[model samples]
Target: MPDAPAPAPVPLDRSAFAADAVTVAQALIGTTLLVDGVGGVVVETEAYDCEDPASHAFNGPTPRNAPMFGPIGHAYVYRSYGLHWCLNLVCDASQLGSAVLIRAIAPTEGIAIMRDRRGLEALRLLCAGPGRLAQALAVTGAMTGLPLDAPPFRLLPRTEAEPAIAVGPRIGLTRGVATPWRFGLAGSPFLSKPFR
Candidate 1:
């Protein structure tokens, strides 16, 4: 018998991101996120909102965080520690400057491209953190404000039922150390860090 065909990639509607960052972050687990056909399944995420002291938008819109204040379902790319590029998806349809940081992904597609971009052969290290994920997918500050539903970005809904999830305080934040906004796929080796 012939091999079974893969199911079509379902386009996740923008309406799915029309919620708060926390909601979107958790819901994004297990979803496949591709950038120009190079990416993988989302395994980890962190939520940020205007009211959170650790959030870039806590002090309101600035030149760097303008995308977070714009319409929902857009990309909010930023640099971390003046080195790595981090990717976030604007949420909060009310325009309150909320976004879900794509912390980590399990590389599934375009492995060769990601390996070349990252200069590594280890699959687990390819997209295990926001910086690494962005680099592997070629996400940069220039991608900010781009509609996630359009080309160069393809978000496919999880075909299987909801996967097990693990939640904990976000990492690398001094202010909101106990916000418990980080979410990841339970027991997934692709997480940036083990959930505590």
Candidate 2:
């Protein structure tokens, strides 16, 4: 039999990300994140609000965090630990300074490219962290503030049948640890860190 036809790509609009960070974070699970011709299923994310101390916007919008303060459906790529670039999706209304950190994704496209970028053969290790996910998809600071509706970035809508979701506090945070903003696909081995 011929190979199955690929599923139609669904580009999400800005309205889909207009909700609060936490809500958008949970809703992002299982959605397809396409960047630079690479695709993956979002499996882990962490939400940060303007008021959260762990949030980059907690100290107000700096030059590095301008994207997080802009309209929804934009990308917020930032360098974490002065090293690898991490990808975040701007959420909430304009000036809300809310975003969801995309921590992990299950590689579904461009596996060979991702393997070369990550230097790892294990499927689950391909995009198992914020930095790794960005690197695997070739995301950089240059892509920050770009609208998701355009090329180099497109978020496919989630399926109607909800996957089992696991929620807990955000990771590696010194403050706002009580906020259960982290969301992941339950039992997914692709998770970056163990769910608390």
Candidate 3:
């Protein structure tokens, strides 16, 4: 694909983003995701459906997961290992507690600051992992429950290059490993390490 104009807002209405979990994951890739005071990063994410009991919000809304219960395109940041922060994009309007986990990102700009913030030496490793991407982009509990279109974080227009998608098991989830909810750029080295 040659250089082209940026895509218009992907109509992130309540219904658009509130689709099945896997669909949300595939749709996020190539979509520009921005972080305020930091910068933007293109999304490369994986979905975890609510049907899967292993999902964090599968049990329903709580203080930590309340953001997922909101309308589509909201940020849901959670703490992991009592240290790192992982970001989830809200979806499934009616269910009110479903989200797609942002497994990774391809840093589009601000590479210098992002690398420093993440303490990473290599560019590929900057946003290679879920927690690393969030930390590098300044995602935290404070950014949770925020709208994607507003400030702090934004999902910019999708680029012209459409990545071929491949689906597989969601990482870290043993119960639904066979569900094929994970989506990534086919043949792209940046795709998450295939679940073993």
Candidate 4:
């Protein structure tokens, strides 16, 4: 007999994101991030809380960071260095100002769309970093505060075995340089440069 096909990834409920930043960051590994028909398996993430100086929520809520202070299970898209968009998943309770930055993902669907948007041929490069993944997935600041369970965006649960995860200090941060809160799927080639 032939092998059975795998089931589709399950869409996560709001309860799934009701945890603290570090817990949500590690838990996000292997989950699928969806934008329209395009999606990728999350491979790397970094946690941030209001207490962290490197966090956008560090000092408290601002007009630019209203989403971080709004609801859980919402998207917190933001511009970085005036160069690229970064995607973060809102976490913890309301007004808590916590989130998990999705740093990298392995492309799984809409390869053509992602490739065209990225203008890159290598599959691994399509969504290898936060900015690249946001670009490839067509995320923008307009999508900020949108519920992750709604149109043009969704989060699917990790259906496979618990991935082997690695932990280390987050990359590209000056204030929280020694904070070891970054999490990534071990052995995944589609990862951003590590903080070595």
Leading candidate by lDDT: 1
- The TM-score values for the models, in the order shown, are 0.96, 0.93, 0.85, 0.94
User: For model 1, how does the per-residue alpha-carbon lDDT over 63-157 read when each residue is reduced to its tens digit?
Assistant: 99999989899999999999999999999878579999999999999999999999999999999999999999999888999999998999999
The TM-score between candidate 3 and the true structure equals: 0.85
- Candidate 1, residue 9: the lDDT equals 71
Score residue 126 of candidate 1 by CA lDDT: 97
lDDT of 2 by residue, 22-57 (tens): 889999999999898796999999999899899999
Tell me how far candidate 3 lies from the true structure as C-alpha RMSD in angstroms: 3.6
Q: Which ten residues in a row have the lowest lDDT in candidate 3?
A: 7-16
Q: Model 4, clash count?
A: 0
Q: Rank the candidates by lDDT, best first.
A: 1, 4, 2, 3
Write model 3 residue lDDT over 36-113, tens digit each, in one string.
645444445777656677687778768877787777878888998788899888887756667888877777678888
Q: Compare the candidates by TM-score and give the number of the best one.
A: 1
Q: What lDDT is obtained when candidate 4 is compared to the true structure?
A: 0.91
Q: Model 2: runs farther than 4 Å from truth? A: 1-7
Model 4: per-residue lDDT, tens digit, 132-177? 9999999899999999888888788887778889999999888998
Residue runs of model 3 more than 4 Å from their true location after superposition: 1-15, 37-43, 194-196
TM-score for candidate 1, please give it: 0.96
What are the lDDT scores of the predictions, listed in order?
0.93, 0.90, 0.73, 0.91
Clashing pairs for predicted structure model 1, backbone only: none
